[model samples]
Target: MNESLNELLYRSFDTTLSDEEQQRLDEGLKQSEGLRQEYDRLKTMRRIMAEQPQPDFMPGFADRVLQRLEDGGDASGDAQLFFEALWLSFRRMGTVALLLLIAAISYNIGSSDNVSLRSAFNIPETTMEEIIEPDFYQELESLR
Candidate 1:
């Protein structure tokens, strides 16, 4: 129940006591039979735990867990599946948009007047004097 005894007990478990702390704990253990008994019990428990064989896992344990996640067995897998679904939906929407664009273009072309391919390439003839008028050149000279 004493604060120092409690601290010493915890320090003993941590194995981080200085010489003075060790001496204090030793003195307390000598003075209190209950503290001594508790210390012994803790030591025995520590020893037992240390002596026990570590549990062995099945082969490819990590690989199996990763595989399960990939197969949509865990939260991460669910997230992956969610992203995949989102991607598929986006792809479908994109395809629909492309088809709509193509349809619109086709409709516009079909509805337009039938102009000959040669007529599209025919540029209207214009004289340079007509393009740049004498009046326009006079305005430029005035600005200068």
Candidate 2:
């Protein structure tokens, strides 16, 4: 019921009370019956929570939550489900990109017999004379 009593009472639950603080809190507890009941309630709640098993969630759950928040507003029901599904599938998007890269490399290699990187990408070897020929190439076959 004292001004500092409630603060000291709550602090006792979470912190190691110093000799002076512990003395003050003990004095407060002696004077107030309600304070004693609150202390008991908090202690019992902590014990009950400690005995319960921890919970788990599906993967990417946190990411989807943050993504929804980043989009600016809260969503519920069907919209929430749709956003969660989108975040969950994001990992597969990386796989999709990788497959495209491999396909491009394969295409580049398959197009040339030489199999070198430049040939795979179809970059041709050229001379300054060949590049300088604005009107005509050094060879007619070069057109192909």
User: Highest lDDT among the candidates is held by which one?
Assistant: 2
Error of 1 at 57 (Å): 2.2
Tens-place lDDT per residue, model 2, 1-144, is: 565777887788788989999998897788789888877887898899999998889899999889979877556867889988998799689789889878887898887777887876567888766677755654654776
Q: Give the distance in Å from residue 36's predicted Cα in candidate 2 to where it truly belongs.
A: 0.6
Per-model TM-score on C-alpha atoms: 0.42, 0.37
RMSD to truth, every model: 17.5, 17.0
lDDT of 1 by residue, 28-96 (tens): 888888888888888899999999998979999999888887877776667879999999999999999
